[model samples]
Target: MNTEQQVETLQSALLARARALADETLARAKHEAERIGAEADTRLRVREESEQASAKQRAERVYRQKVQAAEIKMRAELDQLRWAHVQQVLDALQERLTTLVEDDAVYLPLLKALIARAAQAIEDGDLVAQVNARDYTRLQAHWSTLAAEWVPGKRIVLSPEGEDCSGGALVRNRDNTIRVDNRFEGRLERLADELQRIIVERLFATATPLAMRG
Candidate 1:
């Protein structure tokens, strides 16, 4: 063949080879882009799921805190109400005691019994009996006869000075070492804790049974 014809054929072959290389490179680039897009989509989905889980946990924590706070407030209010009720009962008991002291038919015997009890508790001592102003006068009038009947062996005498009490007697030895406080207020004070426990058990038994058990 002639030189011109041969050169044209070689140029055509080289041009076809260049076109084939361009097509292969374009296909590889498209495949790489598709792979990168899929990876990005997976990463985005994972991030969104993680964020949702964290938000749910935070919301749950806040809900628990609010519930606990409400429970604490409710318990505090109940405690205040229970204390107020207990105080009211105690005040009523004090008023009842005051009324009892005003009735002489009942109070006079109770006073005599209190003196006898105190005298018996002393166990062979020269005793001085102290009482409130009203009781001191009543006892001073017939102390000798009552003393002989109440405490036969012990030398018993009423004090010139009256005691500061509602009713009952305060008997002590001569030197003030041994004593028996049979006064109403003194006895009530000594039994205050037991009284409060009983009051709480009776009043709050149905309302807060678990709390009462504690």
Candidate 2:
């Protein structure tokens, strides 16, 4: 073979090697780009899922807060209604006592019982009894019987000063140091809490929902 032919062959071989290297480099670059794209897609999916979870938790918290607020408002309203009803029942009781005082047959026995109860509280002492104007005259007429039956062996003075009250009397010791109130209005007031509780129980047991009765 000649020198020219050998040179041409060598040039062809070098060109073929260069083309193979270029193809290999392009393939490596494409593989690197695909790997980077796949990693970015995976990161995007993870971020989206995390954001959705956080939003759901926030929604649930807000819902719970709203429910709690509504329950509080409802309970306050229910308490207000119960208080109004209790007042009405107490007013009715007061009206009934006032009516009973108008009947002499009922009022007389009740008044005597009141004086006896007041006198029993102060044993063996000089006591002054004060009653309403109408009751004072009647009681003065029956002083002998009342003195013997209720307060024996004690100086009992009926006050002409007379109180503005129901059938019962207010009896005080000699020096005005101790006093007993046996008035119908006072007795009722002292038991107001117990009366209100009873009223609530009867009303709720028959009229209200089962859940509210407790």
TM-score of 1: 0.74
Clashing pairs in 1: none
Candidate 2 residue lDDT tens string, 1-214: 6999899898888888888888888888888888888888888877777777778777777776776676676677777778788888888877887888888888777877887778888874789888888878877887777767777777788889878776678888878888888877777778888998998887665655323211
Per-residue lDDT of model 1, residues 34-91, tens digit only: 8888888888888888888888888877877877777677788888888888889989
Backbone clash pairs in model 2 (N, Cα, C under 3 Å; residues 3+ apart or in different chains), count: 0
- Global lDDT scores for all candidate models: 0.84, 0.79
The lDDT, on a scale of 0 to 1, for candidate 1 is 0.84
RMSD in order of candidates: 4.5, 4.9
| TM values, all candidates | 0.74, 0.70
